[model samples]
Target: MPRRVAIIATGQTKHTARRLDVNIRELITEAVTRALQDADLTMRDIDAVLLGNMEPFEGFLFPELWAVEGWGGYMKPSVKFNTGGTVGTTTAIAAYYYVASGIYDVVMAVGFEKQSEGHTQTAITTVGDPIWERSVMAGAIGNFAVMATTYMHESGVTEEQAAKAAVKARRNACLNEYAHLQMPDITVEDVLRSEVLAYPVKRLDMCPQSDGAVAVIFAEESKAQRLAPRPAWIRAVATAHEQQYMGDSPKRLAEMRSLIAASRRAYQAAGITNPRKELDVAEIYEVASFAELAMYENLGFCDRGEGGKLIDMGVTELTGELPVNPSGGVMSTNPIGATALIRVAEAALQIMGKAGRRQVEGARMALATGYGGNAWTDVMILSQEKP
Candidate 1:
């Protein structure tokens, strides 16, 4: 049998459009130090390290070669990963496998991004097909705009409802100290009034290009129990990928076949029949406001085309039955490489009662998702009780 794995501690730096005070190395070190302090462990206790970053975004090559010292991987096995925005969660899941395989008892997973150092749009444009989509690509905004338009046409979801998601995320961010966009007084009207970067996708509706880092410590069952009073057990993890071509899945965002498939397998592995009620909270990779509403349906939080209704009924608010994105979600803060990992870390924190002001009251089970490249999806379930 595979060894049980759990997250004993998690840490994050304050997210912002720019972190001029620290370079990439110092930024990563800051998160690592905080994670170690949270777990009451030193570098001596870590058996290995996994780092995630969108190297192209920073024009950096071989990041792990130089980031080793900052992550305390000087004499330990270490590796790096890059999968667009899913890099962070991919790294975390890899670390989980490392410990569960019994090759390492303890591991540190870190994800960081310094978007201010490079041209984010230029880096994102490279994600498209070189010959076909690259020449006409408008980066993430245009892609999401097209997806949002298709969703609106098919599901009857209106701009006002999408703006509600923006409002909820920013308001929720106000409670999270490490979150980037904390708009306590934001309203749907404000979102609609925000400048339109792309049709149907306004400024407030998109996640900010943030400079931040997050770190989480994982350990085997015995080590986990000794490391923390309440370790968030890793119940299940699943990942699904589709063809890279945008036209391959015309209704990609609206239907999100990858997310549906990943969530189905993950929920099954965790023995969850009814996600809306079985899961206490959710931390999703909602890159855009409309994407959140669309994910509500794709993740089986509600029936198809009922996502707007769910949001209208306050079903995803902080005090709702199954609160989603209580950490303000990607719509509030997105460090690209670290965005997905923050979802897992936030879920673990909720289970550990360490989410501070954004904690879901009495949360025992939670779901985290990582979405990237319009082609990949990762789903994970974490709980207070062992699975």
Candidate 2:
């Protein structure tokens, strides 16, 4: 059997619209530096370095060659993953498996994106189904718009409910210093009134493209305590994917098959029969407001079609029964490449008691997820207790 592993430290650069001051390498270095300091380690202490990002988004090919010295991968085995938006979760899982398998004692995983420097929508456009690429979708906005509208029809969720979710995310982001967008006084009405980007998805409902990076140190079980006083144990991880075509499922948004599969298996592995009561906090990937609501139903936080009700009841509020996306979430800050890793980093920070004003008090268990526009999902469970 493989040895246990845990996240000893995590760090992230403040996310924002543009960072013309620093190059991509420097941006990655910023996050890596903070992670190293948090772990109290130097390059000599790291066994291997793993990195990931959507190269198309930044128009870079073979990124490890470009940012070798940036993430301290000098003379170290460097592996890069280009799994689109799920890159972060896939990279972190690789690090965990390496440590758990005894191939490495300590590993660093970095996820970064400089979205301002590229045309993400255009890049995303090139990766869609060739059959319906031109006629059906214009990129993520058009695809998600269809999903959101269909979900509304089948689940009885309203634009008002999605607007509430948007309000919750941005308002919660006000406490996170690294969040890209902070709308402290944003209200549901403001979301409803904002200019619609594509149907129900308003400017306020969608995530902003940002330039940011996030890094975390994963260690073998024995080295975990030495690395940090409190480590976030990797309790369980699960992933699921759907067909490549976006039109594979008509009710894709209303009933996310990949998310449902991933969350169920991950929860089972973590021995969580009641997620809402068992997990303390959740940092899910919601590119838009409606996605979160859809996730609420698929993740078993509530019954099907009750996502709207869940938001209206404030169940996922900052101080509510179970807080979701206390780090502002993708709805407020989405650096596609790093967004998934940001979710994991925030969850680990909560477990380590290192989260600043946005920390969930006495948080012992947390859940994080990664969503890919390519029809895939990754779910990871972290806890204060050893698995």
Candidate 3:
């Protein structure tokens, strides 16, 4: 079997709608330095650097080159991956493979994005098929709006249920110091009254495009023992992809097969059958409230189509049966490329017993996941102890 790989350290910058005060290199350096500090090591100790970014949004075609020098990746092995929103988690998983393959003892993964630097709408719209879908689909929001309509109809989820998730995320953001949108006492009624971006999905339900960076350090078990007193071990990692065309999918558009398959593999690998009963917490990507609801059902936290009810009952809140997205989640602050890594970092901190006010008491096992463009999904299970 491959050697055990674990996250010995993690760090993230405070998320904001715009980070005009700092340049790209400076932003990445901040995250990298903090991660190394958390690991009690210097940049020289890192054997490899895996950068995750979707640079088209920033108009920087070669951001990795500019980022490496500032991030201290002079001579170390380095590579970049761009898998839409899945990039961050995929970068961390790639670092795991590097350590698990015995090629590197210590690896660093960094994810960042500065939407304020360029035109995100143009970048997102470019993903559509130039000949067809681009002309009809409004954008990612419209694409998801279609799915939301299907989810609400087939799953019997009311608009109010989706509103509850927005309220929950906004409330949780108040507890997260690094979160961009920290509304103290947002109510479901507030969400319902919020401006409608698309039918069924209100402005509150959509994630705010932001700028930030997150970094994580991975090490083999032996290396981790030397570096961290309580490493957050990676119990399982899986990724699955589906075709992008909306028409290619069958009925019930929100029922993502990729996420379902990935979740099952992750559960098996982590030896978790009943996630609600076994896992202590979750930090899932919530680009929209509907996505979170669908994830709840797809990840097996509840029966199919029951996720909407789960949110309305406050089952996914910080004080609920299984606290989720204690860090405020993407809906509260979405840094595109960095959002998924934030999920990973938040979950890891929970397992390490380091989460501040949002910490779940006695959290030992946690899960984080990513899902976005092209119907890609990546699931990661983390534990306080080595597997």
Number of the predicted model whose lDDT against the real structure is largest: 1
List the pairs of residues colliding in candidate 1: none
User: Per-residue CA lDDT of candidate 2, range 11-68, in tens?
Assistant: 7999999999999999999999999999899989999999989999888877788988
Provide TM-scores for the models: 0.99, 0.98, 0.97
| Deviating ranges (above 4 Å) for candidate 2 | none
Q: Over 4 Å off in model 3, which ranges?
A: 249-253
Global lDDT for candidate 3?
A: 0.86
lDDT of 3 by residue, 1-387 (tens): 878988889878888988888998898888888898898899888999998889889988877787777666788898888989888899988998999999999999899999899888778888888888888774678878878888888788888888888878888988888898888888888888999887988899899989999899999999898888888999999999877776854233358888888989999998998999999999998788888888898888899889888987878889899998988899998878888888999998998888899999999999999887748899999998779
Candidate 3's displacement at residue 72, Å, is: 2.6
Tens digits of per-residue lDDT for model 1, 54-126: 9999997777887677767787898889988789889989998999999999999999999999988888888
TM-score result, candidate 1: 0.99
Which pairs of residues have clashing backbones in candidate 2?
A: none
Please give the lDDT score at residue 266 for candidate 2: 96
The candidates, ranked best first by lDDT, are 1, 2, 3
- Top candidate, metric TM-score: 1
